[model samples]
Target: MAKAAVLVASFLFVALTMFCEEATADYEGCCVSYSKYQLPFIRIKGYSIQTPNDYCDIPAVVFHTIKGRHICANPKDTWVEIRIQQLMNKVKKMA
Candidate 1:
């Protein structure tokens, strides 16, 4: 019975992995992981907060780079907070 249960669990894991891979391919904008390196402000053009939604599972700060790359960042990181504050200040000045 134990071996049977293990086999079922293993099968389920493989099935879920396949399903997630297809889902990730279908929806290209979700950030499953964050970049480990810190990006400089000069390279960043803008940023957006990614809230958890259907299909997409994690919360992140998505930074748009000057080279047009989407960088997934950890929102809890200090540098992310500083960048957010800087963007907010710029918006406030514009308004």
Candidate 2:
């Protein structure tokens, strides 16, 4: 009986550990997709490209707007890529 209880406890510990690890995985908080129409209203404050890691499957570009909005855009989109490059250039010049 004692051996069976120990085995069950060990199994439960392993299962809980795995569950916690998955639950605690990092995720991008700004996962909203933005439309081109909204771009005109938003002033780009900064941007960052999130490369795929263990937690995320695809890459994403996060835009920080002056109006305090963090927008996540699909990096695969041609327009998003171009806009990111342009914003980066503008930031570089400002620095």
Candidate 3:
């Protein structure tokens, strides 16, 4: 009887842990630092702005390259600002 109870408890614990992990699977990826070098406009496919939040504390711009790589950049950088503007303009035109 005791052995059966222990077995059930172990199963429940493992199941609950797996369920919790799946729940947070959609968690956003964050950048710890920014890239120093600038990439050309033609190479960038898209970008996302990162701001201080409960999970992410650093402010950055994550630039998505055509080659399926993410490049973290300082939002204050001149080239990054220009790239952001370009992306915004493209979206506006699409609407």
Instruction: State TM-scores per candidate.
Output: 0.64, 0.52, 0.61
In what order do the candidates fall by TM-score, top score first? 1, 3, 2
For model 3, residues 1-95, the per-residue Cα lDDT tens digits are 99999999999999997764311102366777777578788888998777878877778788888987777888888998999899889889999
Best by TM-score: 1
* Candidate 3 structure, TM-score to reference: 0.61
lDDT of 2: 0.63
Candidate 1 residue spans exceeding 4 A from truth? 1-26
Q: Ten-residue segment with the worst summed lDDT in candidate 2?
A: 21-30
Steric clashes per prediction: 0, 0, 0
The positional error of residue 74 in candidate 3, measured at the CA in angstroms, is: 0.7
Cα lDDT of model 1 by residue, 1-95, tens digit: 99999999999999997764421112577787787777788787888778888866788898888887788888999998998888788889999
- Candidate with the larger lDDT of 1 and 2: 1
Q: For model 1, how many clashes?
A: 0
| Best lDDT among the predictions, by candidate number | 1
Which pairs clash inside model 3?
none
| Model 1 lowest lDDT segment of ten | 18-27
- The lDDT, on a scale of 0 to 1, for candidate 1 is 0.78
Candidate 3, superposed: residue stretches over 4 Å from native: 1-28, 92-95
Span of 10 residues, lowest total lDDT, candidate 3: 20-29
